[model samples]
Structure formats: structure tokens, C-alpha cells
Target: MIEHPMIETDRLILRKVTLDDAKDMFDYLSDSEVVKHMGIAPYQTVEAVHEEVEWYHSILKEQTGIRWGITLKNSDKVIGSCGFLNRNGKHFRTEVGFELNKEYWGKGVAREALEAVVTFGFKHMKLERIEALIEPGNISSQNLVEKIGFVKEGLLRHYEYTCGKFDDLFIYSFLKGDKTNRKSEH
Candidate 1:
């Protein structure tokens, strides 16, 4: 809760997002394609990114959630991020969200980061359920979560309003001790 705990995979390290990460974060966040489904419009400046970084830190400080800057193991530049947000302690559940620089897409970077975060959620955080809400048209995100073993729960009609309109989201979830999740943990 002090800050996001670092998590390492074979090729990446997930660590706390700092103000220094603004530029790198901005690199992807400013790309309309990268943030197209994220609700908010693409950021146009580092100042906006700095606000984002602060929000990441603030979530941790408030005990609501955590976000980790995803970086390659050999380099410090942030390429993406994956973590839990909207944590519900009483229900022992949380929602997971992730995004990567477009260049890193299709190379399994998001999967690797997500698997690690999912493991942390069930193990370190003692969560009973981890959910992912994907915009219906985002096939890649849907595929990623499915491949990671999350079961498709259903669709929530006009579940959220972001950007300028209402959007439908497909809800997917992985429960603690689920065989699929357990297999990925190892």
C-alpha cells in the first residue's frame, strides 16, 4: 500500500510509476490508437501525463488500488502498465486494467504483465476475484483475457459513459483457485 511492489517476469519489470515516467507514459497515451478504448482522449502534453502519474500514486496512497509501470528488464523506459484498480476489500475482489505502447502489442508483453499481476492479486492481495472490463469492439483485449484464463461473464449494456458517449463492456473474470489461473501462476 506504500507504493506498488515491484514484479519481475523473464523480460519485464513492473514497478512504481513516478513523475519521471510521464514522458514514456505520454508516448503511448498521446497516441489515439493506444487510448482509443480507454474512454479519455489522447493526452497532448507531458503535463497531462504528469497528472496521470499523480493519480496512479494517489490511488495507492488512498488504499483504493495500485498501478505499476511496465519496463523491460534491461532498460528503465516504461513501455506499458498493468495493475488492479477499484479494489473492493470487503468482497476480496478488484478490477484489472492494462495498456501497452502499441509497438509492444502482439509480442506477448501484455500477457506477461497481466499474468504476473493476476498472480499477485490472488496470492499477495488475497483476492477472491479479478475482473476485466473490455469494450465490446476490442477484440485483442478480449482475446488476451480469454487466453489468460478469464471466463466471460456477460455483457453489461451501456455500463459506462466515457469520452462522449455510453459504451458497452464485456465482463470477464478469474476467480481465486480456478484451475486456469492456478496453471498460469506456475
Candidate 2:
């Protein structure tokens, strides 16, 4: 089994999500604005969040993915979650995904958390490439991925079925030896 380590950033702590986090996860996840671009409807109850958290745990156990609950340094409450999904060990590539509380939006929290996660993916997990798929309408998310050095690859038409209709998604990628990663080395 792959061990999930606690990754710390200057303002955030990325750790395994627990049952205790259900309430907090529900807090943000249930917000319409938060789930707008996510393609899913807002969570109706904390119980749903509980089940989702359990599913996240199962994915880790199956060694298919790893999801971390993002909490602030001064608080234990999870403000968001981020992780690698659809990891292909043989190809050394994985897709990164994250969502933050709308309350924390524009505060740079997601960027900080994502940087730590990407660093871990490259240095520890040995990932050669990290990719992100974002809906065309999610300008904020598109900015976030590009700010971190992911280059826009292309659009996948009718890529995902969300909210009852098929939606196009833009793919962005960052490679191991890219300028962003290389600059961090020194």
C-alpha cells in the first residue's frame, strides 16, 4: 500500500481526510458556487459528505488515488481537498484535482496547497507529468492551473457528462523537467 504523508505548506496542511472532516467538507462542498463548475449538484447533507469521504479512503486503500484534506496552519478545519487521480504508475503520470471553500477563494490557498502536492508527486511519487482538466467556463480554475506552469494542451469535446449535459474540457499539463519545476530546484 502507498503511504500517504502529511504535507505542510506555509499556510496549509495537506493530510488524509477523516470521518471527522465530514462536516467541514460539507460546508464548502454544499455551496452552489463551489459546486457550480464541479458538474455535480451541491451536497444535500453531511451524510452525503461522509459517504464521499469514505469513498476517498477506499481509493487510497486500493492504491488508485490519494486525496488530502487541506486545513489551515492555525485551524484543524479542512478548507478544501486536493490530490492525484487517475494515476498511471507505469506511465509516471497523474491528473491533479482540487476544490476550495468559496470563502477562501482568491486568497492563494489553493495555489499553496497544489504546489506542495505537485512537488510531492514529482519528488516522492516519481510522477513524470501532472495534468488537469478544467471546464472552459471555469476561468478561475484555468488561471490556477496556468499560474502553476501547466500549459494548455487542447480541448476534449463532450468529455464529461455533468449536470445532465455533456461538457467540453480543456486539458493542461506540466512535465517533470519543465521550467517551473526546474526553477524550484535551485
Candidate 3:
């Protein structure tokens, strides 16, 4: 199993998932509102949450997608998750996805976590493109993608069939050398 190195940013730390995080994972991941747009459904119990965490615990150290538990510096709490996934092509492209605890809604934590993951993908992992497939009407996530310079490619009509029906996914992307963040003074 190949392990992914931990990553850090100005205010967040991206670490591998462990079964010990079941408590924090259940807190947010079991919320229907939070999981509504996610690929996975909201967990029904802490046991269910642990089931999900266990899978990531194995995959995080394997050939599978890189998943991280997003913890904040000030609180040291796992507010949510964000990571690289769904790799394709000559190991040069992958998808990025994330979710947050409702308690942190309206905050810029998503961007902080996202930018760090994107930086890891490009600057370290060497991926050529990073994509986000957001559910329609998820305006908050849509705005976050655009703010980070990912252009709306188009709507992926019924791109995914989940929760017993077809769901439209918005395809937004950022190229490898997009120059969107090259001007940063930091």
C-alpha cells in the first residue's frame, strides 16, 4: 500500500483518515443536508460512519484515491474532508471533492482546504487537471469553484445516478498551469 503524505496550509491540515475519527466523521457525514450533494449518502449511525471511515483508512494507503480529514488549526477539529480522487489517464489527471460541517457554513474554510488540496495535486502529485462535479443548485459550491478559477465547462446532464434517480452534475475545472493563483503574494 502506498501512503500519501500529509499536507498543510495556512489554516488547515490534511491528514489520512483513521477509524479513530469516527466520532468527528459521524458528526458531519451523517447529516442529510451535508451528504445530499455528496456521492455518498448520509450515514445512519456511528457504526455506519465507521464503516465508511474504515474503507478510507485502507484506501488512503493504497492505489486508490487520496482522501484526507480536513482539520482546522485553531480548533484542531475535523471540520470536514477534501481530497484528490478518481484518477484517470496517464496518472496526470484526477478529481477534487469536499464537504464541510454545517457549523462552518458561510465561512471560507472550504477555499482554504480546497486550495491546499489543489496545490498538493499540482505542485506535488503532478496532476494535469483537477475537476469538481457539483450537483445543480449547489450554488455555494459552484461559487467556490469559480472563485478558485475553475470555469464552468457545462452541465453534465444526468451525469450520475444516485439515490435512486439520475442527478445532474455541473462540471467545473482548473487546468494544471491555469495561472489563477500564480499572482499570490504569499
Per-residue lDDT of model 1, residues 1-186, tens digit only: 484689988899999988988999999999999998888899999999999898888888887788989999999999988988999999999999999999999998999999999998887898999999999989999999998899999999999999889999999999986777434546
lDDT of 2 by residue, 1-186 (tens): 567799988888899988999999999999999988888899999988998798778878886678999999999999999998888999999999999998999999999888888888999889999999999999999998888789999999999998899999999999998877332465
lDDT of 1: 0.90
Better of 1 and 3 by lDDT: 1
The TM-scores of all predictions, comma-separated, are 0.96, 0.95, 0.91
**Which runs of model 1 end up more than 4 angstroms from their true locations?**
181-186
Q: Lowest-lDDT window of 10 residues in candidate 2? A: 177-186
CA lDDT of every candidate = 0.90, 0.90, 0.81
lDDT of model 2, residue 66: 88
Pairs that collide in candidate 2 are: none
Model 1, residue 181: distance off in Å is: 5.9
After superposing candidate 3, which stretches have Cα over 4 Å from the reference? 89-91, 182-186
Question: Compared to the true structure, candidate 1 yields what TM-score?
Answer: 0.96
